[model samples]
Target: MVGLLGWLISFFVLIALLVLVVYQLMCLADLEFDHINPYDSATRINQVIIPEYVTQGGLFLIFFLTGHWLLALLCVPYLYYNIKTYMDNRHFVDVTEIFNNLNWEKKKRLFKIGYLVATLFLSLFWLIWSSVEDDELGF
Candidate 1:
């Protein structure tokens, strides 16, 4: 029962990570028009995302096969950071208008700090969770 639960958790986490990577790719495409230009379409954005996704998938596979709950948990923050970075770069509003509407520097700083703090907390959780033994689960 425990092994089945662990597999399900890891599988769902892997799916979530894949979704985030796909979203990141869409954001990258939105930010960099050159990636879509017919004349310059050879750019390796898709190639890059694929390799990254594969690497993450490999990690999940190893964790699932080995029943390494900690290793699987560690992937959470790593995926979060990648998604956050993509979101930070892919602002939807016009930059000039956004800047004019508010203190752009302050907003940028706050956002940076927020993401940094979030990433740190997530990493810490992953580390702590990874240390927990499988049988330690409370009945």
Candidate 2:
């Protein structure tokens, strides 16, 4: 029971962290595009941004499965670096141009609402799966 509880706690924490990482990435994408071309039909943000989060999420899942708490913990720094790089790249353009192009209110609202819902669903799944006793059932 203790082992199961520990696993559940760890899984929930990892899910929360993964959701945060993904949400940060999405916000970064919004920031990146807001200045250059709000209407630009580029799927690069979705393609590149989402897959990176998925990969990290998969890594966390694997680490959780293997009970490698230290390895899973390292993802926090990795996620930070990913977002930092994305932000640093945004500085090359003129500040005035970027500011003029941005719709800050809309971007903020969209990111907050979308990310909140996504994180909620993801955390719920993690919580559910973590609570299940391995010996009790098959799913």
Candidate 3:
């Protein structure tokens, strides 16, 4: 029973982390396009949101449902890359970068921090999960 509870907790936490990553991707795509093309900001922003949401949702959902060690193996590097990029680019901001500069700055800052933390936690969890015993769950 305790082991079952632990598995449930881990599963929910993974789902939350997946959702958080999706949110971060939305923000990243939004900021990138807004930086590249300032004129079509509204249209560009609107265009990317739905697709980003859908793509991340579907991808993470597949990963969660499959719940295979091989799938987790594939995601580790990607999560590490995101963590590295988030840390590397957290400070620098171009003058044209509107997301972190202007209104809702605090919110954007929090999201960036949260994204990095989530990625780190997710990667660490994967490492531990892989190294630990398979147990009965085969998670």
Candidates in order have lDDT scores of 0.47, 0.50, 0.49
Compute the lDDT of residue 126 as modeled in candidate 2: 47
Worst-scoring 10-residue span by lDDT in model 3:
48-57
On lDDT, the candidate that comes out on top is 2
Residue-pair clashes per candidate: 0, 0, 0
CA deviation > 4 Å runs, candidate 1: 1-42, 69-124, 129-139
**lDDT for each residue of candidate 1 in 1-139, tens digit (9 for 90 to 100):** 4554554554554444445444444433443544344222223333444455455556546564766665657656655654665567642333334324234423443553454354345444544464454436643
Encode model 3's per-residue lDDT on 15-104: one tens digit a residue: 555555454455545655564444354344445434434443444444556564454455555455444644676432344565555455
Q: TM-scores of all models?
A: 0.30, 0.32, 0.34
Off by over 4 Å in 3: 1-39, 68-102, 105-113, 127-139
